[model samples]
Target: MKTYNKLLLLFIFLLFCEGLQAQSKPSWIWYPGDFEVWLGNKMQSRRTERGTFLPPFWKFDSHYVLIDFHKDFDLQEAEEAELYVEGQYNVKIDGKAIFGYPNRLSIPAGKHKVSLKVFSQDKVPAIFVKGKKVVSDSTWLVTYEDKEWIDQSGKASDQSGTTWLKAAQWNFDNAATPPSAYALPTVPQSPVKTEKLGKSLLVDFGRETFGFIRLHGLKGRGEVAIYYGESPEEALSIDHGETLDRLDVQFDQKKDTLTTLTKAFRYVNVQLAPGMTVDSVSMLYEYAPVKDRGSFHCSDEEINKIYDVAKYTFHLNTREFFIDGIKRDRWIWSGDAYQSFLMNYYLLYDSPTVTRTLLALRGKDPVTSHTNTIMDYTFYWFMGIQDYYLYTGDRSFVEQFYPRMKTLMDYCLSRTNKNGMLEGLAGDWVFIDWAEGLSKQGELSFEQLLFARSLETMATSAALINHQEDAVTYGEMAKKLKSAIMAKYWNKEKQALVHSSIDGKQTDNVTRYSNMFGIFFGYFNADQQQGVKKNVLLNDKVQKITTPYMRFYELEALCALGEQSYVLKEMKAYWGGMLKEGATSFWEEYDPSKKGAEHLSMYGRPFGKSLCHAWGASPLYLLGKYYLGIKPLSPAYETWEVVPELGGLKWMEGKVPTPAGEIELYCSTKEIRVKSPVGKGTLRFKSKSLPKVKGGGGLLNKGNGNYEITIIKGKDCVVKYN
Candidate 1:
């Protein structure tokens, strides 16, 4: 009995010791610092940022394992190499199967050793070749040569034990380091008092230090100089600019304070000569030393909160509009470009990453000095600026970029023909299978309509700033171009516009994009509009426009036409498809059938997946403008138009910060309410049917017979019925 008891106790102790060893063993903890997560055992992470992992190989919900190989051996010299883990995972050499585990091994939380062995092709004991054996070198060679790899598993771990491999670093810290400097003070506490003194606009900092000065809408040519002192005579000039360059000057830290000035005249003053007019100005200065210069730290919780609110607002608007839910992979290129235009004035505002990315994508290669293809970059720039202006209401941005904008616009105008039409290469002149089948023969589709719409926007922008001559020129050009388009492309017999001109002759009979352009460019006549509605919107031939490419443009056209029901139905179908396909973020395209087809593609290539956050960011802005009906006239935010068309939505309310102030607009089943810092405008007794707006006051009535209200005080009459 004593012997049996002693044996039992020994067995129990052994089992307990094994369990503890298993628990304490260092299993591979995924390094959050790694940017790219390898999809397969052979894959590796590429780019790292903020400890978020991203994989080089683009795939949806791909599982990755961070394996500590424990040994690194030269691949060239080894007779045979095999990777081994405790679990029953398949092993491959150069993607070729060499060995398979007899029993499936499930990895638990603890340290585990994995091994890799390499062998020469001739089956002889290979010698170590430094550069040749390196995996990175092999990968580069394979990529450059466009060679393929065969999976080799079932190979022995050590055919010839040449040398022991060294262990790799597995545990890495990924905590974010805080900024070394203090946060800059938000402007100065001292009240900035403004007084119009003669031909100069004098600003008194009043015992406060100033760091940056921002001015908006200083028209024509003039020089603005900053000065210090109680009287203009005693003021000393700090910075001076020739020509009207809307003020956006950042002062040096040494001269930021009033007391730091050696002379009494060291004051900040801006002079707008007799011919110039100033819109608005903001003086930013620091009260004390700042903690950080460039880095602005926000917690993940805070960032996520902002993202959630923006996402919710965007989803809500998208749901209301019923835009197609076809999860497009790289479709954000178009959407981001458009949003860039809408928010152009806000490029210097919040969200530096977003703006930087947009700008980076705009011009030609940042690395090389080469001009980009005009339409591609120009369209993107146009959209970026539009979005920037709409969101921030920063007129100074407009002034700074206006010259660049004009330069791009002039380039476009120069490309126009005698017939008042613009022509350019389509699809970068590269023929793809899908695109080829659509047009049959490659031709520039009436896609120039998007360009025309941009022109109209440019014209409207010019008109808003009281550039009457420029407005008239753009409007006339638009009118003539519309007429020429009708004469050149419209087919009265077929009741649809030709898709594009082949060899300068209209040949393709398809009506997909041509009609879309017609709606987009505001070129459709009364009879043609009804025909378009019947043939395109209600047509059953195309099997529901479930592709993101056409869906974006189609939705925009629908909004322009005020066709709520069709827009809502399409939006539901499209968005529903994406949500069902397990999308955490918006996709490039949607496959409704759930076939094994690739979900994300770039121009129909496997490597073309771009998880564009900017593209996904656009739906929110569009929904706000189209569904909620909050439109801004200029960056100043002083003038706005409230025209709500809720479509099939239950209720919607949102706020967009403009230059004039924050514009809050909301709509319910009963009424539509619009509130701004200037005043309030209400449209009462709303129903399923569109509201009838009567009154000339700052609003213009659309062809769909809906009222559009604009609030411009003093200079323009309260109401002018159009």
Candidate 2:
């Protein structure tokens, strides 16, 4: 009897421990990438023009309305699991249907499969299942079309084919919160000042803002019209403002009225009817809850202010996906989002946002048109993925999306002319930049450069997915294209790559686009790089880059060539130029030559420019990658380097986040301090003398005024140099 009792006690203890192990952290999950598609459509459709709804001109896709989610679990004892779903759903256990959508169901002790089929047209099909060993998470498998067919006799078909993918999830961990109820967190914000004009009020929120407008203590019954503006002039122009809200009220008592959709504006002109009345105006500021992981502080206050405003501009534009601007477009353009991805790595480092944006941009591709209807934008999408992999080293994302990448590349290759060069095709927009008088007539060198880089991206992704044959094919294509670009576009006389080729003849037009890219791509020899830098990049004859989009790469190429000092002054002059004009956030475009209200005009409208744009925030990337000089040399940051360039700053310190953690550094002419949370890092610096070490001593004094040190994980290394 004693032996039997002891055995029973051991069994009970094992069962208790198993039960505890089964109930791990539970979170809401959905068909991977589906929520992004759904939310993107909803957000993009919110644009209105003078109270009339305006949708994207390009084709838009929708998420699969029906989905089946299931996971198998084994439990020591029977447990009851709660079910929460975003839409109408049915629950089943081990092929046995529950009587209804049970709030709680008994999942038996033995191995059992729990499944839920949900249908939602407007919202993503998502579910949260919490139980002792049966929690919903990424581990759950989901299928849009289960393809389960039954005969008249009610036996299921054996040949039923279904493709299931692991579910996608974010930070929606609470059971009470479902995907349909999702909205960015909002906070109350008041106007800086308001001016009354009879039944009209003009309110300035003090800066560029985005959110719902609220009329506080609105009582009388009539109609109230609100005009939104990024500038005060835009708000006052009721006839031409891009966005406006109108409400027909019949309030018997005082109540606050808020607009249904969010708008981007800093100033609002509220015009009330003869009867309508509002005591005050405020707003519910909607914003992404992303933690700022990277930072920059330098001696130049102007540069610091530019960084802060640029950071704010990026955060505001980085909502569901990296949008073009808050006011106009409000759509994810691949080129714009590509810059946002780079900036994000230096700022938020939110992997999910990057993945989500990539997936959404790809959509469900039958390859109809280029991303955002621009040829360069499509290549930008692929290049963005390359950077994404190098920065995060998440192979699973590439694995899931490699097929999509292949199809897009195939579309590009198909569009190439007989000579394997990309020229204009019907319905294809060859948007290199927004420069006036720019030609799109012939095979463009810029397109080929981007194409070669995109091919390399595919090659890298193919290798990651173990597609050796595809990898070789893409690698050969990339090499061929690179050689062709150099052979066809290189102008020996001009010492630069010309802009385009007409009928196999190089155009005399030498543009900065391809030449600057070639410098960073290593397509040019050392001699060729110097030649192009002097003739094309530094030459005033080459049309200067005006838009921040191209400026991002132009500056990057300069930084790559160790011209950070020159780039720093350009940054201050360009980005600081905007700051000098009382810009709360960076503008979509700025030309110092444009005087007064002309700064606010673009696209032929008086106030057609967006005051805050994503591409305008490139300094976040420049400061982190080039100035801080911390970059990954291997996948997942297992091997990295820290080569700090002061770039004429008195002293600088910042953090560069990695999958492991942050690589923090402080640098001055006299000393350097470094710490890494993970990965082994190499610290390379140029010192006037042999550097002395503090903390952990491993400084190696290489000859020729150069020093090197190794940084191990979770340790601090300080060096006194110069």
- Provide TM-scores for the models: 0.46, 0.95
What lDDT tens digits, residue by residue, belong to model 1 across residues 1-722? 99999999999998787555333322122211111111111112212211134333222122212221222332213322111232223333333343454222222223322222222221111111112122211111100011222337553433342322222112211112111111324443333577776766676654323244555554555444444432233342222211112333343221221222111111345665445566655555432221111111112232223334325322311210111121121111334344433322221123332343333333321112111333433554565555565555544445433544566677667666555555553423221112435553433445456566666656766765667887788778766666666776777765677667766687746456668657755688778877776676556663354445446666777777778656755655565455444334444455566543355444644323322223333344445556666565544444456666667666666665444445555565555455566433333122334444333244444545445554433222222121
Where is model 1 more than 4 Å wrong at Cα?
Answer: 1-335, 340-377, 383-395, 406-436, 440-445, 454-478, 542-546, 596-613, 616-618, 633-636, 671-673, 678-722
On lDDT, the candidate that comes out on top is 2
Compared with the true structure, all predictions reach lDDT values of 0.41, 0.88
Tens digits of per-residue lDDT for model 2, 1-722? 99999999999999788767685778889887788877878888887778888898777877888999988887768989888888889887876678977888798888988888999887888899888677888889998976867768785432456888889888889998877678888999999999997767999999999999999999887888999999888999878888888899998799998998999999999998887678999999999889999998888898899999999999999888899999988888899999999999989999888888888888886889898789999999999999998888888889987888999888998888898888879998999888988999899999999999999999989998999999999999999999999899898889999999998898899989998888877889988888988998889988998999889999999998989999999999999999888899998898999888789889988888889999999999999999999988887788889889998998999999998778899998898899998777899899887778876438787889988899878888988888
Count of backbone collisions in candidate 2: 0
Tell me the spans in candidate 2 whose CA falls farther than 4 Å from its real position.
1-20, 149-161, 701-703
Clashes of 1: 85
